[model samples]
Target: MRRIITVEEHFDFPDSQTIPEQTEPENDAHVNPKGNDPALVTTLLANFDQKLAYMDQYGISLQVLSDPNAVASTITDKQKAVASAQRTNDHLAQKIAQYPGRFAGLAVLPLIDPEAAAEELHRSVTELGFKGALIGGVPFGHFLDEPQYLPIFEAAEKLEVPIYLHPGMPSKAQRELLYESPSYSDSLAGMLGSAGWGWHAEQGVQMIRLIAAGIFDRFPNLHLVSGHWGEMVPNFLERLDEFIGKIPTPLERKFSDYYRQNVFVTASGMFTKPQMQLAVTEMGADHVLWAEDFPFLRRKQQVTDFLEAADLTDKQKDQIAFQNSQKLFGLAK
Candidate 1:
């Protein structure tokens, strides 16, 4: 079997205490402030040994780790946000140094201050030797294409690092408008707005906003990645392209062109063959990555079974499983 290199794996920041509390739990396990999931992803204190053991057991040769949530995104205090991001990133850099081959890191950015975020991104890539930066949807519900964030985009393009766009719970206004319910229970509302359905929808919308705002056109070298088969974007590309074709937009190419050139999608724990086939058909084998989503749906054997059962040729399977990440992240030079 080919070595598996997974990028969407997450680990909690070891120095989380330095940062102000930011993330609100979207699940029952986290309803208590002190509670944590032991499954490798959302631990309050990261357990490197357990993670390494799991990887060894499951044959994951490399996992690119990032903070489970946007720790800096919800913190309103600028100083605290910056401190949190810096501390978190430094901690991750240490972990990667400790296990350089087994683990890689994606920097946490203080997006509230875009200029500072740009500086931090450069530092992480140049100084810490990180693979890239991971931005969780938006900082405090603002989209990435806003002018304040242009510097961060420009910096990422200049730095040549991929931006892994992960999901954050929607803003209160957004939740109230689309996901809230007077009749349904709060648990149901949370489910609808988060992992069950709305989280991917929110991520898909954010990518669309970036496309519509011409961020891709402005930063031609910018690369983006999203999990869960691009949050349903690939399936809907034709419709999106139809609309873009009709608009008097600034995009230098059609919507699908951006996807083909700049976007990569990951499995992110959904290991069904049909979905993988659709992703490969739309994005090509090189643009699809393999992920387990970890802890949230921590079932490695299921993924193993699905991949073994998949109809893709050996070359295609090798590309999605490891080779694509190796090239995109420059893991093999």
Candidate 2:
């Protein structure tokens, strides 16, 4: 089996009082049925031993862990958010230290205050030895394309670390407008709004917003990691480029060009050949990373089986499995 480095793997701070109510056990089941397993949540919270065993069982060499709850992003109070983020990062850093070669960390930032978030990101990379920051969904109801969030992106570019853009639950207005339906149960609507469909759609829109706002133009070297096969963006890049060209904008490059240049995508729990082929075709093997979205989707055999059965050359498979991640995250070989 090829060495594997999964980047989208998640963990959470133990006794994290800041976890959003929506992420509580009862509601989480509705949002993501995969998370209904209490054992999964236990593993996500602090069961490092089980995580390591699972990795060993599946031949995974390393996992870059981040907070799945995205507590910092959901906390409304600035002070609380900042404190919670620091505490969470410190907790994760300690955990990574415990398992030396088996794990790396991604910082969770308090994006409520952009400047403070930037400072925390710098501290996380320099002091805590984290690989990068992971921003979960639309923080503070902002799409991250706004000027207020530029500091976080600027910090990432300056630090030469990629930011992982993980999906978050949609906001109230979004849910009411796009996901609510009298024809279906709330659970179905909740699922549809989240991991089922809306999550990917919203993430794709956010990426486009960043490009349209000239974020990449400003920070030309900024790197972003998007999971779930570019959040469904890569599949529609050609159409986006074609239509976006007709709209007048000051973008320095085509929509597709920005995506190709500044983004690295991961196969986070998406093991199908067609999506993998499309991602490799659109983003190139060098720009693709491997991930399992662990604890959420524990089908380790499916991931390994699909990867081994993939049609790509050995080198390309290696790149997706570990080489790309090592190069991007500066992981030790």
Identify the leading candidate in terms of TM-score. 2
lDDT of 1 by residue, 229-321 (tens): 899889999999997798687678898998888999999988877888899999999898888866556767665667766898989888988
Predicted structure with the largest lDDT when compared to the true one: 2
Off by over 4 Å in 2: 14-29, 32-34
lDDT of 2 at 3: 88
The TM-score, computed over Cα atoms with residue i paired to residue i, of candidate 2 is 0.94
Worst 10 residues of 2 by lDDT: 20-29
Model 1's alpha-carbon lDDT is 0.79
- Encode model 2's per-residue lDDT on 1-333: one tens digit a residue: 678889999886743566553321223336643466867666555788889989999888999998856667666678888888898888888878889899999988887789999999999999999989898777756799999999999999999999999887777567768987999988888888888887788888888899889999999999999999999899889998999899888987898999998899998888888999999999999999999888777877876777888999999988988999998998999
In every candidate, how many clashes are there? Answer: 0, 0
TM-score per prediction, in order, is 0.91, 0.94
Alpha-carbon local distance difference test for all models: 0.79, 0.85
